[model samples]
Target: MAKRVLVKFSGEALAGEEGYGIDTQILNYIAGEIKSLIDAGIQVGVVVGGGNIVRGVTAAADGIITRTSGDYMGMLATVINGVAIQEALEHIGVETRLQTAIDMQEIGEAFIVRRARRHLEKGRVVVFAGGTGNPYFTTDTAATLRASEIGADMLIKATKVDGVYDKDPKKYPDAIKLDTISYDKALEDHIKVMDDTAIAQAKDNKLPIVVCNMFEKGNLLKIINGDTSLCSVVK
Candidate 1:
């Protein structure tokens, strides 16, 4: 198992079947999964996206709001998700901390690299909300940034799909699932495993990323246990 890792949870995954808003069952399941990792002696940090509430880029494309404002709104949405997850974890008796890039002192602590590392070392799951506290950046980038800052052994992106594919599996009947792929190959092929900026950042930092399906029971634990068959490892 990895000694330390960062997991990126897409907001959409938290929404479950309803397609919007947090689902109690899904939140509890995810919290349970994180607790399992913690119990196994793996230090875990999380960066969550706000796409379920509002995708900044998508909202901006609709032309009602500027991209900057939309992004900030999205960041706030992440904090909401962070808080919800924190509550779920704590309710299940897992010690967790919510840290935001943008200050929201009443609820969460400001994001500090040292403080976050300390929390992880003390066995607290640190949830990073607010995507880089900036516009024009996806949460994927934020996840990579946090993973690099915390010196994580690996970045695990929890998605709805089982693994990275040559094409969208839902759209392509014969899309091949890649067990392993180079950063350059993933970027060159325009694979949607992650945004280009995130892939580039991970590549530059020599950080390996595992893309896996969060909905699959015991998958995260299996991935941490070095079960490569359950996910795609990108180096």
Candidate 2:
């Protein structure tokens, strides 16, 4: 089977120490990581969240802007991030394509499943943005949706932590890391690996979910090479 994978990145991963905006260093690092995957003959797709810019739920919390408008704004934020990643990847000589769920002719091509598949087949990394082009839907759900559409072998949720833990490792000193977890257990125990909807979708599709530390260099390569020590696999 082809080693096609979808990477779901949280918006905060792109942020700086202050956790407020895009960090070029982080972007470059992630680009390099993606480049390594491509060089290793893996087709990659990316879906990034907009929390670093603005979260729709937070925006609508004050009840000033409606949830619908806030969600749309969040979608646009993802586009900004998508284009940024595209530029970063291209700067490092990785062929890339930016496709948005919503039509934005000047910025990116409108998302088409066939086009995305073609891009992947040609060894181009496809950056999926605009969050399913629907209100009240999150980037997590968008990642799963795109992963299923692309027939990806796995969905990787790269985070600061190395793997899934029985509890919040930060708050609980005794938190135990799980090398492998079931989708049902992750959802039942609220593992926080991915959103509930995203996890459920992965379960339905029987797609394996790998959680690894994004900051760790070579972790992606290691995990893909069957290094179980580096990640937690949810299946």
Candidate 3:
């Protein structure tokens, strides 16, 4: 049976060859990959981050805007990304829906767990936008929360790196990638890959989390296909 997977793609992953903005080539690639998953009967949900465009915390440091206001701005950035992804997917003939935490009736439906589930069951790929509708929470936590609420089988975190490493692989010469690791170990060792809150949420829900490279072609498909040995799995 096809599993219900919540894919959390970071903004950096969408940077593609140019390293900024929505790269049409990469979006099409991702859309094609996701369409394959939908064709194979998988229920797909996406939670995209907005780091490529703006980060609330970074803007809050200038003292010009309050943290809450900055975070809200970041949330809006996610909505922009969501619309881009929705358009890309729809252009490829994939049925897609964008549900936001912030109510914007003109763009997409406000996020309701049950309604989102219904859409998934009906074979529509649902894109979850807007952070938790809260200021402090990161999109990582939003992904974890949504995955738990939607009863997804796993949270597939699409990162720039292929898998989770003991340290920042780019900075360290001997960073080791783990094929499988426990949530306890990730917390105790301070992996720094995701926020502690997000990890804790996933651990509490006992949802399998896989960290993989989104830029690599067919990686997402392999993940949904249950190739556990291919990526870093946090159990």
Candidate 2: residue 38 Cα off by (Å): 0.6
Off by over 4 Å in 3: none
Global lDDT of each candidate: 0.94, 0.93, 0.88
Q: Give the backbone clash total of model 1.
A: 0
Rank candidates by lDDT, best first.
1, 2, 3
- Can you rank all candidates by TM-score, best first? 1, 2, 3
Question: Of 2 and 3, which scores higher on TM-score?
Answer: 2
Residue-level lDDT of model 3, residues 118-194, one tens digit each, is 99999999999998999999999999999999999999888778888888889998999899989999888867667
Q: What is the C-alpha RMSD of each candidate to the true structure, in Å?
A: 0.9, 1.1, 1.4
Off by over 4 Å in 2: none
Model 2 gets an lDDT of 0.93
- The weakest ten consecutive residues by lDDT in model 3 span 11-20
TM-scores, all models, native as reference: 0.98, 0.97, 0.95
